[model samples]
Target: MSKKDYYDILGVSRDASDDDIKKAYRKRAHQHHPDKAGGEEAKFKEVNEAYQVLSHKEKRKQYDAYGHAFEGAGGGAPGGGASSGFQWDFSGGGFNGGEGFSDIFGDFFGFGGRGARRKTNQGEDIQASLTIELEDSAFGREKEISLKRVIACDRCNGSGAEPKSETISCTHCSGTGEVRKQFRTPFGTMAQNTTCTECHGRGKVPKHKCATCGGNGIKHATDTFTVKIPSGIETGEAFGVAGKGNAAPFGGTVGNLYVSVSIAKHPVFTRQGDDLHMKVSVGISQAVFGDKVEVQTLHGAINLKIPAGIQSGTIIRVEGKGMPRRAGYGKGDLLAVVNIHTPTKLTRRQKELLEELKKENL
Candidate 1:
């Protein structure tokens, strides 16, 4: 019986280039692979046989010159006399022509022996920013935040298919998540392994796709979560909450949610590490003599004593009154910087008293 034409089997033109021939053969191989649903073993074998003859440079030349006559006569091994219709040899009995089909397809598709491993379906992580009052950071607080992100479909539960739908092995890649394809480029016919587009590399096809997610198994949704703000957490720092990010599409692990924190600027105090610094103004009389004053802290107002003969730019400390320390023990002290307020406008009695004092001192 006459063998099928190699070019016709691959659905390519008679003058197809070596790369084009390989590409055509690759698509046919996946389409007819017996491992896939509705696969045709005979057609898959025919495709491989056609590629075997047309893929090699010397074999293609012979096939082009002598047509099926070269293969019909069994040709000569790999290398022999030109007139013998065999221009090349299998080198070292490599192509014994029995059980070499697997190796040949393996080499053509980069399957090594069987094939590459199936891909994982882990979800992607998401990031968001949270702003809080400085007091919230000074003393630990819990905050509830809402965010819009991609979440698993509640109807299908991230499966991508509707309930009661039957899943079958993929027909496009024969249940392989990856498909081996050949393409014609400027360089030459190059073979590549790509994720199967039909099933999105899931190796299975759903009879009915989920209507809500459109077979993506996810949807945009708003979710609420409560986050703990640890004391002493500075701005630009981030914390992670497990399984709070975008949900995986096909039953994979859920990703994490990263929350970046920012503290709003405070009007009364400036924070450095765990310490709070503030400026306090006193009258000249209060500075000259001892006085007691109230200062603001993160918690509440506290009394601070001013010693006699205090000068401007003097820093007074109120122990255990500042922000709480994150680790170890004691709270930071509140630093009060004193500035003596000189009278801008003096009354006549004050002017007279100052003049008399100055004269006595002189």
Candidate 2:
């Protein structure tokens, strides 16, 4: 039988870029991986074989020019001779001196060619939330938050050893923090170095464990700390505090704490970006004639002049009376919407006055 074309196998065009070929290979490999559900082992090997030739510039150039005849010219096919037929070899130096293939496998499979170690020293990050009033955002304030997190053990000083105890190298991995193992997959046998289970990748064990923390180097505790909320901070904005998260075991690097702020809804004022909006009620007479009215703002109540013959729903801009500008130096304006108050019930004298005004056309 004739061999299939490499481009057709990868489902890519003949002029596909190097990046496009790599992406296609990853997609095909993931789809046909033997460990996945409904995976086809033979198709998986075919995809790997196709990627092996196309990913290399020189091999790809030869394959494009000579087609299957390139293999007869000893273009580094599976075996030394072209008649030996094609085979998948993932053993020593099979993938471009192993670096490129190692990176590709490490990204998707979480394991590389050899000497791949899992990173466990860094502590996990913590997420928290803080609720504040809208007024609090107008003016910055410091708030105290409480949360339970992992902290370094006080008794061991985060060393996982007693005050005078001695430290010794791990016997399982001989201080290398990793152990070599061989895995048999559909492609071939793969050698992978995994983290040593006995030492947990630390490569050391305390001769005498700490009494309080039992050599864990960490403890669970409820911590309280103050966080500063900046002025004009919007809802859902997050601020980070360094070194306030969980502490790594055996005194490794500490993670960060991210706090998301949420602003409570105000009963009177509505915030639009940096601008504050509120409705100010005016009497019918006040709307007909000019009048000064007290308007509520985030800062305080201020006197706002109502223009003569002002119509209902008219917006009056009050400069420098809104929320403080979070990015710049100046404050935003407060928009006051005018609402005319119409009396539902009228007394006899009020009705008579309206009758006289109607007759005069006022």
- The top-ranked prediction according to TM-score is 2
**For candidate 1, what is the lDDT?**
0.72
Clashes of 2: 0
Estimate the TM-score of every prediction.
0.59, 0.67
Q: Write the per-residue lDDT of candidate 1 for residues 239-333, one digit (tens) a residue.
A: 88888887877656778899899989889888887888999999878888879988767778877798999989999988888788877777887
Output the TM-score of candidate 1.
0.59
lDDT of each: 0.72, 0.77
State in Å the error of residue 26, model 1. 33
Tens digits of per-residue lDDT, candidate 2, 1-362, equal 22688899899999999999999999999999777898887777778767877897866775686666533433232234322132334463222343434433332222222121225576778999889988778888888889998999999988889989998998899998777655444356555455676566889988899999998788999999887788888999988889989998888888889989999999988999999999999988999997999876777878899999999999999999889998888899899999999977999998999889999997
